[model samples]
Target: MTELLDIFRALADPTRLRIIALLREMELAIGELAAVLDQSQPRVSRHVRILVDAGIVERRREGSWVFLRITRDGAVGDTIARAGEWPYAPREALVIAHDARRLAAVRTERAAVAERYFAEHAPQWDAIRSRHVAESEVEAAMLAMMHNRRLGHLLDIGTGTGRMAEIFAPTARRVTALDRSPEMLRIARAKLSGQGLPVDLIQGDFLDLPMAGASIDSVVIHQALHFAQEPDRVIAEASRVLRGGGHLLVVDFAPHEDEDLRALAAHARLGFSDAQIRGWFASAGLLLENTETLEGGTLAVKLWLGRRRSDEDQPPVTQEGQGQRKRLAA
Candidate 1:
C-alpha cells in the first residue's frame, strides 16, 4: 500500500506528470529533459529521481550519459495511462501545449544531428549493404537457418538499429539488444519500445557484455564484427555467455580486399575467411553446424551456425521474465 501510494504521490506533482508525457515521445538525457522542461538539470533530476523510485521510469548509464524512459508493460504503466487521460484544466492544457512545442523542438534537433551523422555515413553503409544480397533475402536465410529451433534469451550484439532483434523477436523467447552508441540505442529503443515481445535495449560494448556468464541461449552477430578492433575477443566473449547446447550465428562479409572501407567506414578487419572464423569458433568451444554463403555484387555474406559443445546449459528466464519495456511510462 505504501509503495502504491508512493507512486501516486510521485505523479501528483505537475512537473513529474509532464515529464512522463515527454518520455512517451522518446527517451531523453537529463540535459535533454532540462531543455524540454525549460528547467535546470538539478531540478529536473530531482523529479526524475522521484519517478524512478516510484517505478514510473527507468534510468540507464551509457558511458557518461544517463537516459530516462517510461516504465512500460506493467500495472504501474496501465495506471499511468489511465491518469494521462484525465481531463485537463485550462492551466494544465496551456502548460501541456507549451511543453509539447518544446518537446517537438528537441526532437527536431535530435533528428538534425542524426541526419548529419547519417549523411556522412550513409554512403559507407549503403556501399557495403548494397553489395550484400538484398537484406530481405539475408533475413529469410537467417529465419530458415534457425527453422524449428528454440531461440531462448537471444542476444543481438552491436544491434545497430535493432533490425535483427525486431526480425527474430517474434520467435525468440526474449531478445536482449546490445549496442555501444547512445544514439543508436535511442533509435533502437524507439523501434522496439511498445512491442509485444520482451526486448531489453542495453547500451554497452559487444566485447564485454553486461550479462552474466552462460546467460544467453542464442547469440546473433550480424554485420557488426567487421568493425570490431578485435573480432576474436568478441567471439570469445560470446562463447563465455552461451550456455552449452545454445546456438551461435555469425553473419558477415567473406574475405574481401575492400581497402576503401577502412578509410570510409572504420572497418578494422576487411572480412573474415572461413578458416579464420572457424578457428575462432573451435577455440570458443562452439562446433560449426553449417556455413552458407550468399553472393552479391562484389562481396559474399557468410552465415556460420554453431552450437556449444558442452551438454550442460543454464536457462536464463521465460520470455515474460525478460522485461516489460512495452508498458514503460507513457
Candidate 2:
C-alpha cells in the first residue's frame, strides 16, 4: 500500500509523468534526464528516487553513469492503470501543457550538449572510436548496392573514413562524400585521394544536404543512422536526391539495450526494426527491395536495399538497367 501511495505521489507531479514518457523510448542518465526535463540534476534525481521507490522505475549502472528506465512493475504501473479508469478531466490539458514546456526545455539543453560533444570530438573521431563490425562486410555491402547500377553519380552520407566512397569510387563516375566533421573528412580525403579516386568531400549535416532533388543515382549511409538527430528527415532527404529507380543502401548496427547511447548520442531511437524502416521508406515514396541482417561478434548489422519508384507503371529496375556488368572494376 505504501508502494502504491508512493507511485500515486510520483504521478501527481506533472514533471515525473513527462519523465516516464521519455523513458519509454530509452534509458537516460540523471544529467541527461535533467537536460530533458529542464530541471536541475538534483531535482530530476529526487523525482527519480520517488519513482524508483514506488517500483515504477529501475536503474542500471553503465560505466560511471547510472541510467534509469521505466519499471514494468511496482506501485507506479498500478496507479497509471487505475488513473485510466477515471473519466476525462478538464484539468488534464493544463497538466499536459506544463509538462510539455518542461520536456521541451530539457530537449533544447540536451541538443546543445550533444552539439558540443560532436564538435569537440569531430577531428579525432576515427581514432577515438573503434569499429564494432567487420570493415570487409561494410565494403561488401556497399559493393553489393553498386553491383547493377550504372554508377554515374553516387553520394555517401556520413562518410567517415570514406569506406563506402572508397568502394564506390572504383565503379562510380563521380562520388560525393558528405560529413559534418572536418577532421574526419581530412582522413577520408587523404585515404581516397591517395588511391587516385575521384571523390568529392563535403562537410555538412546529413539532414540538411546541399544536393538538388533527383541528382544522384545511388546514396549510401553506413553505420551512421544511429548518430542522426532526425533520422526520418535524413531518409526523406536521401529519397529526394535519388533519381527514380535509384537505390539507397543503409547499413547500421542492430538496436540493442544501451542506455549510454541514448544519453550521450541523444538517440531518438535505437537500431531500427525492419517494420519501422519499411514504414519510413514507404512514407518517403521509396520501394523496399531487400533487408539482410549480418551478425558480427560484437554487433549486428542490418542492411536495407531500397529503390525510388517511377511515375510510369514499369516494374522497378527493369532488365535493361539490371545489366550483370560489375562496375567495381577500376
Candidate 3:
C-alpha cells in the first residue's frame, strides 16, 4: 500500500531516524531538534514534514513555537516506537551511540538553562520544593489516586511548567494548560509540545477561567493555590466549569509558619489547611472524596480529591477505594 511505502520512505533518511530516536527521550521543539541534529531549520522542517505526513510524527503549536514528537497511537507509531527496542547491527549501533552522546550534551545544556531560570525567579523554588518529598513520589501518588476514575478532558490550573500535563496526557483525552504569566507559558509551551497529546496553552486569570461552564471533566490545581490571593475563589471558578461528575485535584502546602515564604517568595498566603480547603469545596458544591498528605523535611504537601455533584435527583456516585485517610504529615 502507498501508506506503508510512505512510512518506509520516511524512515529511509538517516536524519529522520535520528530525530525519531531523540524524540523517544523527550518531546522537542523544532529549534531543539535542529540544535540536536546540527541542521538548518528549513532542512529539519522538511524531514519533519515527511515523517508527519507518514503519520510517524506529530506537531503541536504553542504561541510562536512548534514542537515535534514521534506519534504514539497508531500502527506506524507503534512500529517506529519499537525501533529503539530492536537490536541494531554493529555499524548501526555505533551511529546510535554517537547520537546518544549528542543527546547527552543537549540535555546538559537544557538542565543548565533550567537551573538558571529557577535561580532568577522569586519564591526561592528550591527552598520551598525541598521541603516536600521528591516530585516523582507525589506524581505517582496522584496517578494512584486517579486510577479508579474515568479519565477525560483535564484542565491543569496554573500549569507552571506543564509537568502535570505531561504526566496526565496518557490518561486524559485532552489537556488544557492555563497560566497567567506569559514567560512561564512560553517555557511550558516548549516543554510540552510533542507526544501527540491535544494540548492548549492559555494565558489567563485563574479567578475567571476563559472557558464555558460545565465544559471540563477534571481540573487540577498543582502547587499554585498559595500564590493566589483568594484560593477559595479560584476553587469556585474551577467548579463552575466542571461537567457533572468531574473531579478536582488540588495539591499545595498544608498550613505552615513559613513567614519567609510570604515576603521572599511572593506567597500571598502561608498555606492552607484541610478544614479550610474542604469547606471551600463544599461551598462550591463539591464533596470531599479523598485526602492525603505527604510530609517533607520542612513543609507538608496535601492532595485533596473532590467530585462535583452529578444531579440532585441522581444517586450519589459511590467512589470505591476510599480507604483510611493517608496521614503522613509530621
Model 2: residue 200 alpha-carbon error in angstroms: 0.6
As a whole number from 0 to 100, the lDDT of residue 258 in candidate 3 is: 82
The per-residue C-alpha lDDT of model 3 at residue 178 equals: 93
Q: Candidate 3: which pairs clash? A: 123-265
Off-target runs (Cα >4 Å) in candidate 1 are 1-8, 54-56, 71-109, 186-199, 309-330
Count clashes in each candidate, considering only residues at least 3 apart in sequence or on different chains: 8, 2, 1
Question: Which candidate, 1 or 3, would have the higher TM-score against the true structure?
Answer: 1
lDDT of 3 by residue, 1-330 (tens): 888888898889788888888877776778888877889999999999998999988886655757676777768867976887866778877877787787767666656655567678735777767777888888998999888786598999999888899899888888999988766776665566434566777767899998999999999999899999989999999999998899999998889898988886788988789999989999998999999999877888889999998776266444432232233232
lDDT of 1 by residue, 67-120 (tens): 888886576778766766778898998888898888777777766665677787
Which stretches in model 3 have alpha-carbon errors above 4 Å? 1-115, 119-123, 312-330
lDDT of each: 0.85, 0.73, 0.83
In candidate 2, which residue pairs get closer than 3 Å at backbone N, Cα or C atoms, i.e. clash? Answer: 35-106, 36-106
Backbone clash total for model 1 is 8
- TM-scores for every candidate against the unseen true structure: 0.76, 0.54, 0.62
